[model samples]
Target: MADLRTTNPDPASPYPLDPADVTPAGPPRAGAGVGLAVPGRATGERGFVPPASLADFAGLARAALPAEVWDFVAGGSGTETTLAANRAALDRVAVLPRMLAGVDTPSTEAALPGGRFALPVAVAPMAYQKLLHPDGEVGLAAAARAAGVPYVASTLASTPVEDIAAVGGTVWFQLYWLRDRGMVADLVGRALAAGCAGLMVTVDVPVLGRRLRDVRNGFALPPHVAAANLPGGRDDLAHQGTPGVSAVAVHTGAVFAPALSWADLAWLRERTPVPLLVKGILDPRDAVRAAELGVDAVVVSNHGGRQLDGAPGSAAVLPEVVAAVGERCAVLLDSGVRGGTDVLRALALGAAGVLVGRPLLWALAAGGRAGAEAALALLAAELRDALILSGCADPAAARELRTLIGG
Candidate 1:
């Protein structure tokens, strides 16, 4: 296993998603993903053409996976208004580039509350990966390791978090904030013991958003898949639904603590020694409160439009959140992050880094580990191009970029 966390297990490094690299480097940036093997295409792999773009991966994955599975992956909460808004919000942000600033070979490396990564992006936590492809989270983590990025293993990951951590890269565990504090505490202990670099507490889903498509499709995990980390290997996450009701919403309403609040967040902050990040902050006040409570970071997200059908896109709310807590804690953004330009937009808006969601899954479903690597490489290359063109020499410099909304 990569000793990135082993070497610096107590990663309470100040959140540095700011205009400068002001955050303290907790320890020598652990080998910068040294143990993860970089992948190269082999000639013997038959008929597999690497994806030229994320959309290409989406196309391939759509055709390859079952329609029900695709719906489960692609569908969102009622009316999907928030889902479409996520992409539209990203589309509205335009970067105004500088002339003759002589920036070239812009370094994509960025530091977050967890660790520095090859790019300013990490994989967003999603669950039950085996349903997407047989290789699942393990394969995806290997690819992320190879690309020098962090993988936020989901609470509902098909494989155990310990196994995912063993894949030899920086792994952060995404906790779902279950009603049982003891159960939650045990999960945290397991992740820390397994050498996870950080613990991100997802605070959005007090109850699962009612997804209409899942209701119409009546989706559920196949017999072979289960949430491996839960005691007794129980898979309680509501992955799908029935004709009239969203099973996920119903189960979530019960299994998860609908009463989860700021006090609960405070409890979590005290429970774990690792860098604690609070995910699902759209309001500036919430961001401020989290920062005040000693949170190392906050992920501004709408759960990839999977929850809260009417909520604004993460990009739309990012600037305000950063303005609220950018100086106090790291602010990360997710939702509708389809390309490198989006990453640039997030940074320009004051996010320390961005968490990529569905595109990586599309790549994984399209071509397994190699596909995921290809996706990250494509994003990194595109981010470098955007930075160079805009004369931003490093990821942090993008913070000073001038942007116009609705351009």
Candidate 2:
């Protein structure tokens, strides 16, 4: 049996990057470069440099993106309190580093539901990635495969899941679990047929959250980017459109579903044999409930703070959730995770892995596939450094390096 463990690299040690960790180790690939040889550039020469950390990526993305785009992608609900708090909470957790141990090559491998990944990080499911670049999810999937990480497929993906899987391997499906059961079934069937490794059913969103920035920007779904799972029809506007809101009137019915419940999990479980994961779980009690429901795993998230303005940061709630679940199933986390240190922090609290949210979109928008690949590479480097500096020889060692700051 494969070891369900993580190996940390030493920062101070003489450990150098293996060939797989570098850029030139693999073949040269282009991303949604829009007719150019490079992504986000007219020439083969890509202009932007992939940031080394979350902060670096944020600065680069801010400089590269428009105000409206950034707001729609990065902004949270109402006051954005939860959005800011996510980072703040992550900053509160400190790593108890280890001393000089004979360390050579450090690995950031993680054991996921279907298989393992090179790193404990994945790209979170986001909608309308084509808005960020022409290639959209296809480019992202390619980058994930190249970087040896998994790409979670969003129901709202501009690129069809089948097409994405064709371009890249090991795709996971994320469902909004709409009011139409048949639509959900069809998506599951498609995912299974496409060889998806797992199913991530997002449970928090019954209706769209109060994304003030999206409303202010008059964010409407672009007509070209349609949900491949749903049929094309305008008469079903009642299901797709927000009843009172005109600004969000054009979004697909796929975005909101008020009929979701735990009962529906039974129906969902029967649809696919793939490992089922419940996303948007923040409460420890809910984590316990999810494990009881026989979910293969649970992701501690607040929907990137895009939903529920006052919710605690996912990192702040991770320990409690972990305690509740008690290793019954895998525990994954998202929201405000930007670097390897964040991965280490989440792992210290018992998260099996972490997901990258808006920063990835920024990388895609700024540089396309190459940019996204570079972004993943930088994160892997950071994770390796974090493991080394923290004196964690492997993933199991992270359990020992954890230090609770308060009661």
Q: Could you estimate the TM-score for every candidate?
A: 0.86, 0.84
lDDT assessment of candidate 1: 0.76
Q: Report model 2's TM-score to 2 decimal places.
A: 0.84
lDDT of 1 by residue, 284-319 (tens): 999999999999999999997889988998899888
The per-residue C-alpha lDDT of model 2 at residue 110 equals: 78
> Lowest summed-lDDT stretch of 10 residues in model 1?
15-24
For candidate 1, list the clashing residue pairs, or say none: none
lDDT of 2 by residue, 51-134 (tens): 446445554444444444445566677566787778777878877777886555677787877888898877888876876666
The 10-residue segment of model 2 with minimum total lDDT is 1-10
